[model samples]
Target chain A: MASTKTEGARRKAGRRKKEDKASTADLLLDATSELMVERNSAEVTFADIAEHSGLNPALIRYHFGSKAGLFMALLERDAGGTFHNLETLVAADMPADQKLRHHVFGVIKTYWRYPYMNRLVAALSLESDSEAARFIAERFTRTLSEAQRRILEQGEREGLFRKIDPTLFYFSVIGSCDHLFTARHSLKFAFGVEEIDDDLRIRYSDHVASILLDSVMV
Target chain B: MASTKTEGARRKAGRRKKEDKASTADLLLDATSELMVERNSAEVTFADIAEHSGLNPALIRYHFGSKAGLFMALLERDAGGTFHNLETLVAADMPADQKLRHHVFGVIKTYWRYPYMNRLVAALSLESDSEAARFIAERFTRTLSEAQRRILEQGEREGLFRKIDPTLFYFSVIGSCDHLFTARHSLKFAFGVEEIDDDLRIRYSDHVASILLDSVMV
Candidate 1:
């Protein structure tokens, strides 16, 4: 009983050390995300992030190879859950319509949380000849396209949705999901909506899902 | 008769001189537009514009007052037709469905030609406390929202379309229209589409129009 207790205590101590090391990186990432959301832009500098997190600036380069590397990590951290949830939803044993509604809501919710994500993705992807860009393209962009293709195919097999080109549909659906967040100025200036609260987010999600679902329904 | 001929010749000379002065500004704007499309970005500089147009950099400032002024002028030159066309279409006696399709096609075509307009508009409007930003918010953004409102109202009045929030519809429809051009990198990486050719543009227009029309149909 003494030996067993000793081993359990040692494992707990090791886990604590591991988590402590990981938390620094997590803290930096959280700082960057908060700055991005607060500024509604991806133009935050290393100094800003360092000051925000109260960490040494050198630690950023040590943890992430560069600014782009840091942004890439932020993207992964912010989007990891979204991609996983999407895969599970695509494979879930539910009707296509229900799955689609959930997927639409999921996308809007992701954007709502990380309104700077789409801009970050676009900038990273547009960096010519960067390995980070290629990784994002294949990992994030391709994954999204493939998931969409599968959902459309499954929906067709179930006779719930008519045929539509997945490529065009990608532009249409993702575009619809992204615009409200991207054009916040327009929202405020044109409609007097100064903020995207939970209520507006829910209504926007329903609006997009209903329109797009009707667009593809048989 | 001799005096009349002289007067006519003098008037012709004046007209030629006026055209010569105006064409320089037009040439600079055209060069800027060409550079934007070629680069698929709105980051063109005045030196680049001068180099492309073979005109002095001072001419740009002289004509446009500043870089922002130049971009504002470009937006006006490119989008003036679209706004007028929209107003005319909204006031036309055609059924709402037809009008919607035509509007969709018109918007897609405009983005196709000036793919940088959306980015330009976003930047200008995001410039806080700037008179130009306010002008864009009122002249361009508000104009679009008003036109959409009129269309939806007409559609409901004709009993040909179901009721939907114009504000949400603005996000959905405009977002759908702008995404294809804005996410060109996604097109290449995700779907192997390198360019937005006329064939692709037409087909995309039809897809958006048909799906959107179905969504709003009574």
Candidate 2:
């Protein structure tokens, strides 16, 4: 009976250990996301994360093995879904213009909702020499290329857009949207605006859509 | 003539002092520009500037008076002719489309030449309470608004563009170009490209111009 009880105890202990790990991982990710917005990736430390997440510094080492690992995990969690969602959204059966609109809106929504993710990505791209940057770059490029291909193909079929290289078109559209928000402070300070309101966003979005459609469409 | 010799010596010393100040100021600006690319504005220090610029640390303090002053001087020097040139290029008696094309190309050239300026502006914008950030924001807004007004007046006069709000159009064009380069690292990483080449840039400029013209033109 003692042996059986001991076995049951061991199993229960194992289950609790797994639960503890899962919770710690979740806490670390949440903390990283919060800190990233206020600070650059290079400046972040395990100590700050421990203090914020309420996890021991050793726990980071024990679980993720290092700060870089923790960072990678955070990125994996955030970007994995975003990239997948974008591909699905792009590939869905819809009109080319509608697909383009949805794709742009989806990206804006993702950036708005998880601003920390954008900051982290931006910081990593700027500072990191690791595979993370390469991974992200590859993902962005492939996605953009695919999106351009689809837009061009659709535009050709509908006889709407000019026969311009889709790559240039893609870059222009995406570039405009990213810069507006990234350079928000400059724009606001220069223009004297308080915030980029919904009305303004819509107006901006429609303007882009019109410009792009008008240029490409026959 | 002991008095005459003394006077000559004093004047020579004064000329040397002015030369020293000018050279020191230029060094600080150059150092700041280089460091701004590798490090965020917050991470930069007086020591780093001094070491990088090969000037005395005290000289930076003496000339610029503070880090902010040095940064402002750097921006002023870098962006000196960019805005003025753009205004001149766009304000000429050309068709609205040609003006838009010239403006787009001019911006691309400026950004390509002074890539660090984009980052510096971006970093400033993220600073919530920074006076520098406020200044940049206000200036950019005013610039964009002015551009919008010019485009609208020109387009309307030429009977080329629709009666849409010029501010919205201005935002769209700016957004497309700025985002393309600012988020370039991510885009390049995602796509597996090195640099956006000249051909691509021209295509992008044309595409942006086409879109804007198409949206506005009758």
Best by DockQ: 1
All models, RMSD in angstroms: 3.8, 3.5
Q: What is the lDDT of residue B111 in candidate 2?
A: 63
Model 2 superposed RMSD (Cα): 3.5
- Candidate 1 regions off by >4 Å? A1-21, A54-57, B1-21
Each model's C-alpha lDDT? 0.87, 0.68
lDDT of 2 by residue, B1-218 (tens): 99999999999999999998798788787887788655532357889888887788998889877666666667667765577876786678788867777777777776665666666665555555477775565554566557667867787888986787665656666667655566677556665556867876777666676677777789
lDDT of 1: 0.87
Candidate 1, residues A59-152, lDDT tens digits: the string is 8998888887888888888886689889999999998889889988998999999998877887676566477767677877788878888999
The candidate maximizing lDDT is: 1
DockQ of 1: 0.63
Q: Write the per-residue lDDT of candidate 2 for residues A1-218, one digit (tens) a residue.
A: 99999999999999999998898888988887788655532357889988988888898888776655676677777666677777776677877777777766766655444545544555666555667677556655556567667767886787665677766666676665555565565445666665777776766666666667677677
